[model samples]
Target chain A: MDVGELVDRAREGQPRAVARLISLVEDAHPRLREVAAALTPHTGRARVIGLTGPPGVGKSTSTSMLLSALRAEGKRVGVLAIDPSSPFSGGALLGDRIRMTEHATDPGVFIRSMATRGHLGGLSWATPQAVRVLDAAGFDVVLIETVGVGQSEVDVVKLADTTVVLLAPGLGDGIQAAKAGVLEIADVFVVNKADRDGAETVVRDLKQMIAYARREIRGESWRQPIVRTVAARGEGAQDLVKALSEHHDWLVSHGELERRRAERAADEVAAIALRELQARLTDLHGGGHLPAVAKKVVERELDPYAAADELLAALRAGRG
Target chain B: MDVGELVDRAREGQPRAVARLISLVEDAHPRLREVAAALTPHTGRARVIGLTGPPGVGKSTSTSMLLSALRAEGKRVGVLAIDPSSPFSGGALLGDRIRMTEHATDPGVFIRSMATRGHLGGLSWATPQAVRVLDAAGFDVVLIETVGVGQSEVDVVKLADTTVVLLAPGLGDGIQAAKAGVLEIADVFVVNKADRDGAETVVRDLKQMIAYARREIRGESWRQPIVRTVAARGEGAQDLVKALSEHHDWLVSHGELERRRAERAADEVAAIALRELQARLTDLHGGGHLPAVAKKVVERELDPYAAADELLAALRAGRG
Candidate 1:
């Protein structure tokens, strides 16, 4: 249970060790910091990609196909599949990983599924940490896939170096708008199940959406590419891969990749801080001090802002 | 901005005081306890109802019709329409409130729209306080409507004495199974947009679903009432109202109303504690200690569990 040893073993390319270490992190083990500290300086080598969309949208299928294509090209690929947790069970619904059985024997591929145990964002607690694990494990490409909640896929934007939103045909316009906002974050948009009706419509809609996204980041240009694919058949897998390579080329050409990585690093710092604060706040509540404060707040003797200020001042005074 | 003064003014029917006080509570204003304490004893008097489902399920239209019907009966009703913050304006999507414009002049019916501000679980930080305000304002019933996020709908379940999940027809079998587990919490089931195709299939599925929900709570003898409604046209609205009434009667008959209220109060206690903890935990990461810890974690010299434990222990020991 000593987190330091686990981090050491995980870094030595031990799969079980890596998995166990991540479990500790997910449960908010106090030593998570030590593990992150060990892993932090070693990252920035892997290209982390994020894929997210509605439940039935064939994300898993596309991910499987992408894995095959990447590995065929002799790339060491690691997939961080963010799965949903069962509220009653407090464990992940591992159903999504059923399709990932093909590469179990392949040492060149590493797949880790992290449960979003009702975390507010679609991604889970240990995702960035796990990404670091994959990065240190020397994986050239890391793809993090999220089972997105309705109309909110913004979380992936913050997590991925290149965000891909996998959209199916037949979503119509308003639902498309909800997805439209998600599209703005997409470096590559794929209309999967292209054989289905309205594939062209989705592609056209994505183009219009890309136009809108472009206006926001005006003149600093690398257009969000729309790629069509039938993932099940691997029909357009090559084209999708080509689009990814071209997008990477475009990012390097425009100097956006380095800038984005810098932003992402800054975000990591903030997210870690936020995560730490959240844990302390939870502990304070579990202890006796907060409920009384809350009761007083509930009773109208205190207010939340004043309570927070008091708590913060107390924490600041207390932190050595 | 003293919430105590505002709560008192609001109690005295001062509109500005009411608006200002609710905003304070919504923002988790520090003096909330004082305001809430003043209003606490006024609650548990109204049968707070919650209406929730995905967007485009006619929740607003249903809310308007029910408010009008309740008003016709000469009863005071309060509607808390919850909308997500608009991506463009960073404010409540005011368009959601546009559906209820017909009752703008009706003093007997008060409709307020609040932003969720990215709170998952169908529970907003301001939700309970808003309900308390309406209750203290002497409304006979308070209906809090939310754009339900899947799985996270349990948040609304914690607040409502009766949770009504409005579902449209033809969401498909996969979604139906997804709804199966959550539907057990429902007191009255609604098939909104009953005129749409596959209404019968949805109702039939619910019947089968109730059988499972019933088995889960075998000792608790309650039959969930399923009502079909075309909310936009007011069709089946009366039956829906009747069903709600009968459900209330059943609650009283089974002595569940008091039990549910006690449960809800317990939940409020837990929620406050959890929020308090989250705030404190987040404080540690913000204190410039996390980056160091993350580096340690990444380096494999420290494991996450031990690191988390050490960090938390340090805080606790410092407290000592």
Candidate 2:
């Protein structure tokens, strides 16, 4: 519970302290405010990268490969494997973390798996806070890996300085990626399993889509590069790393990094504000207001918008 | 847009009027409040059924078969095929709607495909409003079919009276469903493509999971029946319909139906209220308040929670 001592230990690169800080973020613990306040001054130094794809895309392998590549540069790396779909704290997804344990004894590598556990907004609300913990803990780079390309996953990736979308053949994921709106969010695309058949097709398809997307964009935009990787064998790791560095440079030069970080902060702040207002709304009339208004709305005595107006008025009156 | 007259026409079962009302909902039109007020009285009568599964599980086929079965019973049916992943309105997913055109001409059947078009909350916010339009249009049943088993899809299913989680052989979806927390939301299980090679295995796997889940429940829980169906061949349509009716009866007899509706209404009202608050927050300082607070947070001068507190105070001051 001594947040200052814990943060000091975390800043000294103590993995246990860093893990505890992130757990606080995940649990939405009451002392989270104190932890955030203690960690704020030391944050914003680490570079964040996000990796996401459909299931069976070898996301963990790609993440592990990236961790090794980043480590070769003598940079401390943090991995947050986020499973938005999993309700258990470490269910099924923790099994994927086993593949990552090759770095368990490495002092510079920290990996953690996060599941939603029925969180209000899934893991999006907690992800940035967890990233802040790692960033403040002095990791040179933080990699966020999400399980699926769902809306929540997209939201998580938006917090990254660079987003790498992985895809392979025979999953029909080339079009699936586009359909899920991954194409717009991807800063770099990795065609993993490059040794497999139809890898060329996935690359070609992504190339065409990226070209098409480029024409629609008005201002200066970084063209998303397609990197072919046989990640299981550690093939193409250097190229992927190089591509990531290039995208990071582009983000910085174009001022997109600052803009993205500020936008993420805004989103985080807004979500917290809404959660606070929601808590106050729930507390109104001893939590009876919602159910009462809901009953009236269900019974056709009121519409939802009017019901919302009444609730807002109650909120104002209570504030007064 | 003559919401009163439109509601009257919709009550008379005019499909055009119903379509217009739903279009207004989808557009988030300014007159949506008027439309909702007009439609409120006629809702609360229709049974809303939600069908969802992984892609290529024959969701469209199952929905088509169910539509046929429901129409054979002389019941008016409305279909809302929601593609939350699609960024374009009715893009790519409209192809699936073509297969349901046979029912398109049936005056008793109303079929519509809704794409999110980058809506703030995906299609979850618009779906209930669209369902209200159908309910007020004198539909006896409304079927909501979503593409994937993502978080947004789960949110959509929570609005349904009976939620059917479909799976097929060879998709490895039995475990995927459990991993995605779909097992907890599904009221019924459909092993579509029942004639396929691995159909029995899927049924057995689901049965085992269902039994495992049943043991975890403390109170009166519906034993989610695993129904086998070759939806593509129109087989098991009657069985599916029978199972739905049984679940409906169980819900009503247990008072769970009223409880679920009330919960859904409360969620709807809260979402509207949150959207209003979000708009007001955005309008503060001519939209510069958020970015300024966000910049401060990004610079680590203030933490996000404190930034949220500042925004909330500004909201109150502006209101006063």
Candidate 3:
């Protein structure tokens, strides 16, 4: 139950310990800083892959296939599915959890789901911390699958080193993908469900889009590839894995991986600091200081901007 | 023009001046604090209404009908269509703009569209400030219409005094509404496109859900109303408006208005402070203070919590 033993067990691939660490992070426990400090030395080894697309695009199936492929290569894999779409939906409805039950008994595979149920500031606050916990737990690869319905996909981009944007054939997905703004965040484009009727058109459209994007991004080093896959049947899984490995190698050789990791760390630090500020502000509210300031603003005696400045000064004064 | 003149003109209900003020807020201009301070006294009069639902639920059409109905009652209205669903989709596709274009020259109506075309923190950060501008511009009713795809609706709840959740019949919208967590947030539920076959079923389902919710929520003051509307034909717009007015009265008489406004001011203050912290952090990054800390964390010499603490200390030192 001690932090030291939990960290030790997590590093030794104990699922219960890993789950506990993540729960501590999610709940923002008092000892969270201790857990992060303890886990820091063992982190930064996992390959974080983000899977995103429009709804019903087989993202979960693709993720499951990728997990199996990586495990076949003798790698320990962890899955973190961030479901921002479902309000009260959990564990059972997530396709990744349901479909990947075949690997439930495999000690090399671990899966966890994080859903947003009215959390302040939502997914961005807790995701990077959860990623760090998984990374420190000695997973060779961590797959992050998020429903690409809204801002969740954008948040996924900040955490994953390699982001694979999934797209299926029909439902006007080509235009939907462009409209949803996933074109810029994709490092590898997977046209899953390629056996469908309009799959070829989706593939063609993606290739053209990527071509135009490459021209627009002249100085960018890595060229994003479009791969076709029937992920449900496991066809083209090996090719997707190969493309991922090639992209990973390119990232390492070009030194972009280090830059990305540094940026991710900076974001994580900022998020943690902001959460701390919010908590401190909440304390001030409970103590009657913030309510008084807000009352003045609401009564038109003070402006919100000036009120915020006063609150910030109080926070600093308290810190001092 | 000077901020004083801009504030004066906006107060006088000049469209250009109001547009300029909102643009300044969207761009986070240097003089935003001044604008906020100036607009403080003129606000708190507008009845802020939020309209939200899933895609293809006729939210925009319903909004248009409501706008016309309010105008018939001699009310000046401002509409902010927060489209978090569409990235590049802006004012043109926003239903309030195109459907309400007949009111383009009506001095009593103003419409603005906000899309997340790569804006940092997106709509939630700027919405409260924008609402203040509209409120101060002498609009009797300010309607905020955000696509209820995900967390946007939750954010809308924080800013609006009356939230009207729209749902059409036969899209399984009843379940969708519950799944989107709108049941807890809806002050008035408007079933748009009620001429459809399953409209009564939708209304019945909503009533049952609300009844169950009321039982679960003991001591809640107000009961949510479900009104049917053929928005395209403007059949039930008056009833919807009446429902909104009743809810607003309830909010005022029950003293929930003050409580809600105070909480809103608190949120606005927190958002402004957080934005300032982010700007300061960006400056630190530019000045090498933050990147140095991030580097230490990335190199495993420092944990992220310690790095955040160091950065916060540097921020305090800068203030000193």
Best by lDDT: 2
What tier of docking accuracy does candidate 1 attain?
incorrect
Q: Is candidate 1 or candidate 2 better by lDDT?
A: 2
List model 2 lDDT by residue over B19-94, tens digit each. 8888887788889998889888878999999998776688888999999999999999999988755221123456
Q: lDDT per prediction? A: 0.66, 0.83, 0.80
Q: Give the alpha carbon lDDT tens digit for every residue of B1-320 in model 3.
A: 59888999999999999999999877888898999988998998998999887666788888889999999999999998876653322323543457768878999999987654455546666888899999999999999987666665457655899888888776543554354266767889888888998888888877878887778764688999989899989899889989998999999999998999898888788778777877888888889987888899999999989998998888888988
Q: After superposing candidate 2 on the true structure, give the runs of residues whose Cα lies further than 4 Å from its correct spot.
A: A86-95, A176-180, B86-95, B176-180
Comparing candidate 1 with candidate 3, which one achieves the higher lDDT?
A: 3
| Candidate 1 chain B lDDT trough over 10 residues, lowest sum | B84-93
Candidate 2 pairs with clashing backbones: none
TM-score of each: 0.75, 0.94, 0.94
Ranking by DockQ: 3, 2, 1
Candidate 2, position A55, lDDT: 65
lDDT of 3 by residue, A193-266 (tens): 89889888878877777777667754687888888999889999999999999999999999999999998888
